[model samples]
Target chain A: MRIPLGRKIVTYFLLSTAALLVFMPTLMAVVMSFMTNQDIMTGSFPSAFSLDNYRRAFEQFSLMHYVINSLFVSIIIMIGQLVLSSLAAYAFVFLEFKGRDFLFYLFIATMMVPFEASIIPNFHTIRDLGWIDQYTGLTVPFFAMAFGTFLLRQNFKQIPKELREASQIAGMGEVKFYLTVVLPVAKTSLITLGVYGFLTSWNMYLWPLLATTNDSVRTVQIGLRQLQSQEQMNDWGMIMSGAVIVIIPTLILLFLGQKKLQRGLTEGALK
Target chain B: MTEAAATLSQEDYILFEQTKRKHRYKQFIKGMLFLLPSIVLFSVFLFYPLLRTIYLSFFLTDASGAPTVFIGWDNFVTLFQSSIFQQSIKSTFLFVLYTVPLTIVVSLFLAIIANEKLRGIGFFRTIFSSGMGISVAAASVFWLYLFHPTIGFLNIILDTFRLEKISWLTDPSWALIAISVTTIWMNIGFTFLILLGGLQSMDKYLYESADVDGAGYFYKLRRITIPMLSPTLFFVVTVTIINAFQTFGQVDILTQGGPQNATNFIVYSIYREAFTNYQFGSASAQAIILFIIILIMTIIQFKLGERKVHYQ
Candidate 1:
């Protein structure tokens, strides 16, 4: 169908405007990060770029520790989620068991309950377990993801049953079939879940903040917030630099992981 | 295919698969064992905290980190009585009022526009959606500079337009609006993506059918789009309401609920009471209130959603 010219122009205008508005802060942050303290205080864009803000951010904040911590957490989260979620999803798909559907739905039901409902009890549990101020406390709780398992199970369920039957007829054990066949087939879903796991782990704020009082275990998010809250004058340049530093890795990861995200989305969308 | 099926007896297949099937069941049990950690984690970490938080609401706290007195609904009563708490409610309600429907409408508009067969749509979607990755605290700090009175970019624009300068973070009247705008900008992309996803999945035949009936774009939108998009709309609204209630980080970072507590939200109040004042009981009470509000709102949304949403 031929679309009207006016609607076309309007659509383009609105989309570009929305895009610019969404991007304005990051753009401004990039500009502000290079400016000196004087430029930031004076509210003037720097005529020439300086490395002072980056230097200060690195030296004073020890931002690297937080970034490295965030990376460590994200990596562990991804690996743990990939292995655990895929295994659960695989079992749900090919395994015929009593109460399977009920249990699977129960897992999905947890997704509807907001984190607020869980926080108070979780705090006590962590306190009881003496896991507070520990990385295990931070990572262990999120290692099982119902959403990831659900997504992967949907993909895994699509595999031909004959493939499993054929493997069995050829004297392959169910474990071997799952390892060799089911896993490789669902690799894309696993990657997608890994991306999601990484993002959630990286962007996590409240739980990590609550769980770990130790400064050493603080993620980039906590570090950035801490830097902002320090009673010193608002150092826009350093803060923006910190924001940039925090954001860059995610951006790079997103770029590489976009294909996975899209693929996973398309697969889920097909449902 | 028929010959291959005939060559393999159904009995042989069932028997061959029987051991595998039983083993698969065992594997399923083992998988649940792997899933057990996450299940136990969420139950302990999430459900337990929630219950404890609720329990903490009935008591009063002294400086010694203990509940000194049993105050039956006193905290709730006090929460309603305090002008500050009232102000927070008003602030949080105002935030929801401004952010929720506006965000839904604005994002829907953006999604509809983006969903069209336009060139470079993917790039625009990516740019807008990138905002979702940035934390609320980070966005607030960025906006603090952008909305700054003297050196801020917003002021620069306002000055050029001969408009009076607006103190975004500091001024009582404008702080909520300022924060709301930033919140909307930060979250609009998320709802936009969701609506876009919904829009993309819609069957094209509906539009074709609308065209056959001589429906204009608006008619098609009102009739076909709105009804079909309601599920996504419901999801967006539900999530946004939850998010809006938890508006602590931005308030903490940007305004600190300052300039006469103009932007003090409910969650921020809880945070301050618990951590800042170390009034653990009172803080826990405030958190319980917050939880109750969230729980009620969510249930209402879901209940209303079941009735209201019409899938095509």
Candidate 2:
């Protein structure tokens, strides 16, 4: 559908204006991250940009340490969710046992129990496990996801039945079939689950705050909190730099998987 | 001789049925093996905590969260009478009210506009959805900077317009609204993406038919687009409302449930009651309340969503 010239101009005008409004806050943060404290205090766009804030953030806040911890935890949780959820989804779909639907629904029902409902006991569970300030504490509870399993199951269900029959006919065991056939065929779905897992884990705030007291186990989100809450934390430039660092990895992931990730994430949520 | 053959066949049939039953049982075991990890984790984290939170709500607990006394809803009574809890309840509902509809309407507008098949549309789509990339901590820090009492960009803008600067975070009147603005900005990314995906996946043939009938832009939007998009809209609204109720990270960072507790939503209240104050019983009660509110809202939305909203 081709638009008239005036309409096209108006469309572009509206789109650009809306985009700028949406991006304005982050854009300000990005712009301010390079400026000195004086520029930010005066609310001026500076003529000179400096890496001083980035350097100070790393030195004083130990921001890089938190970045690594966030990476380690997020990736570990992603792997755990991928493996465990895929296994459960494989059983739910490929096994075809009696009461399968019953079990699947039972599993999916847990999605209703938001973390707020369960955070108390889970905190004690971690503390009791002596996992406080441990990577395991930060990563383990999130390994089993009702939503991830459901997403994977939805995709796994789409695998052709004929493929399963062919595998069995070829004397391929179910375990081997899931490994070589089912998982590989559902590759896109797996990436979707993986990206979703990574993003959620990376952005987690409360649990990480509760689970880790020390910088040794703190993720980037908690790191930002600690940095912001520090006494005399008035260096807006440095704090903005830390904020920029925390978001870069996920943004990179989103950009790389832009077109596909949208569809993937939407399918994961909607299905 | 024929009778003997019939008896032998019946014995063989019984033997075959027994083996088949044994094989089916083995498959069940295998499936359970696949599911065992998740089941164990859920039992440990989700199921146990959910039940424990409910159970703990009725009983007073000492420090370390050990139940010391069974209060029989006295904790709830205290919460009802408590002025702070009342404020939190008010703040939470108001927070949802301030955030959800505005977020939905704004993002829906952006999604529809971004859906236009125009030049450089991908750039606009990326800009609109980039909020999905930002973390709560990062976004809050940015907001904190912007909401600073002095030398904040927002204040700078206000000064430029010759309007007196409002205390964005400290003033009770404006704190929740400021935080709500942050929440709305944070939400636009995911809501827009989902809504845009929904808009794009719609069958183009409907639009084609509308074109043939000489339907104008507003006519097609009103008669065709909105109704067709209702399911996605319903889904977005449900999720957004649930998220609004669970507003925590921003509140914790921005106000710490402060400035007269104007921004202390229920989740933050629960966090303080349990973690900071060690009043596990009160916190558990609050948790259960939050859960029920979300559950009821979800059920109501689904009920309405089932019969009315979703045009499916």
Candidate 3:
């Protein structure tokens, strides 16, 4: 079962090279974030490391505020999707009624309508309700999710029917059984869905751009845009620093939830 | 219950039927209740906006986005004739064509190589799929610096090779390619992870049988691995193309559809039309067009997937 040493060496060389190539963009940004503008211009390595770029990124650009706002909005959207989608998915899996398939497809059909395709009207509706520059505008519209519901429904379907029948025989209400028995059975997939929701919301760029106009409500993605515009050419270090800052939390989450993320993404896409 | 029902009289059977009908009614209400929260949100957000989009696409709208006059098919007419909209459509399709295939091929290569059992394969796997953690704006900015005209690392490398330096994002000809390179890189992480997962889950017995048959590596790959990986490959292509179609953040941050609208993709065009130009009617028409294209693409994908994929 063991591979030969020659093949192993070739595999290692190819993989490391590919990994470095794949990671080069990020690696360069991290490296240059510490370099001085002069050093960057001169194509030389950093003479001395400095926090000046990080300092300017926070002070001159107000990236700190954006970090907080993005976290708040993403967290709300994440929790909202998990609670709402899980409830809807529970109904789809456990409850049988007239027009069940019809309603389920009706929900699934929303996934076909790209938000970009329907964004103009949604913006109008949000503006009419005076939600522009508000967190509600950012978070509320994403609460209902067809994709999450479908994912959880798949997970729930894998649970044995005997469990539900036995719970019923034991005089357990559907609601109680769903919370205590059903949710726990699919806990890994649920967490996977939650992490997926969080990643999607965290990486959201288009909606937040239209939804918020002020620094108080802007996400870090928007903040990065502003920083680039304000300091386009002269401050490469600061811009790279700002980019790094925006990526920190997501990186942390990825490191913590790598397995769940792989599971969630593959399942969500293939299914 | 079956034995008891066999002994039941005709009147009792009628009573049982009535009780079953009542139970269905009760279950229906309970199901609706569980679904109520999502339904309410979807109705207000997704369903209503969709209808409004269709309605407004048929009308001329004011700057505030309210319908001012009913114009039957005029918006679509204008959209078809406008050079800019036409260019946007072309750019979008080209972007899809440019990014999807390259993303799949390269990701599959990495997945195949990384699938080998090595001491530090786990580390390589993580590094290979690290782009999934990067946000679009951040990734765009990183690429922007590397694409900087005056002092970019890519151009620096080119300079060392005694080659002419190229403008990464300035020239119209190179800008879309630049954005495409960025996109292909960004897509690598997700696609690689999915492909790697698929590769890992394949049965070793298939490969062993190929070995027992004295098949060479490339032959086994051609006959067994690719066929087994077709499902994941199909899924990856569908999602990658969809992502390419809806590309926005990178375009906005990198080029802003600049250098003569070479990168003015459909989604960005819709944004400019509605929010900037206040042409909701035209934007809605464009959105509807995008929707139809996606709907058709999705249908084609599903059809091909069902018909062509090999399953074990």
Candidate 4:
């Protein structure tokens, strides 16, 4: 069953090429970010490295403001979704009430309806609430997520029933038990949900675009688009630098929570 | 004494029933309290918007984005008649057709290649998975650099190969293709990981048995591996179709629905109609149409999958 040398070499060659293709664009972006405008225009490797592009990206495009906006929106949405979904999941897992199963199924059904279908009405709702161009508009609608609820509910159901009974006998209130015991026991899944929520919120484009018109509330994704459109074909280095800045946080998140992110993604499919 | 004992038992039973009722009421209240936040959010954001969209689809709206006139079925009729909407439908399906199958095939191939247990395989997996780190906006910007007609990396490579420099974004024919390429590259990481997971989780004893049967790699893959991996493949296909149908970020950033509406995907079409043109009624209709299309596609996939996918 030993593989032939030729076939093995071919497999390695193909895999390496595929891997290179995947990595090359990000690598190029990083390389181009430090290059001068002239070097980028000429499509040559940089002879001299400088921070000019990053400087231009910040000053010209107001990249820092957009970064802050994106961070603010993503963090708020992450925490909000985590809190709300976990509470909802806890009820579904531990509490018994009439129509509980029905309500849970209804919540799950929301996942089937894509956000695009509801954007028009959502826009009107946000506007009517006087929330447009505000952080509330950007973050509030996304605060409760069906996917997060489902993921947490699955994990919470796996927690032992005896633990709940023991906590009850110990005179621990439901809130206290949830905060101290349930959350800690389901920490990994919660982390997974958090990472997923952050990434999705950070990468959000359409909702933010529809909800915000002013520079004051624009997220990084929309900001990058504006930068690209405004700088169209003029300063490639600056634009690539903007791109680099936009992806850095997400890349860091991926690095820090690779396992959680992987599990979260596969969780949807496997279930 | 017997009469006193009967009275005591009756009091105890009445007390037990009262406490049970009280406890049930308390549990109900507690559960509702815990669920209140999600209920409020979902009602406002998801359920209300969904029903409103359907309602808006049948009525013409004013400039302030409020439904003004009862235009029963007019929006849908106009949408069906409009050449732009038709083109959008065509372009969206084209985009899906171009992207989903190619992505599945390419990712499956990469997964197979990366499935080998070799030294430094973890590094390769990281490299292959790196695209997952890039946001759509970021990826579009990076690709915008590469897709530049003159002095871009792609054109430079084309020059080296003695090929003509193609206008990747501006040309109508190439615009969708360019966007599709960018999407495929960005999506490779996720699909690859899923397929890789599927491949790795496959039972090794099957392969060992195949080897004992004198089956070659291709034979084993075709007979054993593919059937075993069908469940994962089904999942990937379903997810990919849904994702491809909702493609917006790339089209919005790269082509803005295009040079000649060649890259006008369904979501982008809805966006342009609702926001840019202020045609809420039309947009809602289009949105509903898109929703139905996705629902039908999902149902069809599941139906087809049930027949083909071998769940172990």
Candidate 3, pairs of clashing residues:
none
Q: State the lDDT at B103 in candidate 1.
A: 89
lDDT of 4 by residue, B100-139 (tens): 9999998898888888877677778777777777889999
- Please estimate how well model 4 matches the true structure, expressed as its whole-model Cα lDDT: 0.88
* Candidate 1 local lDDT, B162-197, one digit each (tens): 999988888899999998988888787567767787
* Predicted structure with the largest TM-score when compared to the true one: 2
For candidate 3, give the DockQ. Answer: 0.80
User: What is the C-alpha local distance difference test score of each model?
Assistant: 0.77, 0.89, 0.89, 0.88
Candidate 1 Cα deviation (angstroms), residue B270: 2.1
Query: Against the hidden reference, what TM-scores do the models get?
Result: 0.86, 0.98, 0.96, 0.95
Tell me the docking grade of candidate 2.
high
Model 3 agreement with the true structure over B131-164: per-residue lDDT tens digits: 8889999999999988987699889989999999
- Report DockQ per prediction, comma-separated: 0.42, 0.81, 0.80, 0.72
Ten residues in sequence with the least summed lDDT for candidate 4 chain B: B302-311
The TM-score that candidate 3 achieves is 0.96
Residue A215 Cα positional deviation in candidate 2, in Å, after optimal superposition: 1.0
lDDT of 2 by residue, B172-266 (tens): 99999999999999999999999998898888999999999999989998998888888788889999999998888998888998889999889
Model 2 ranges with Cα > 4 A deviation: A231-233, B301-311
True contacts kept of 2: 0.81
TM-score of chain B of each: 0.85, 0.96, 0.93, 0.92
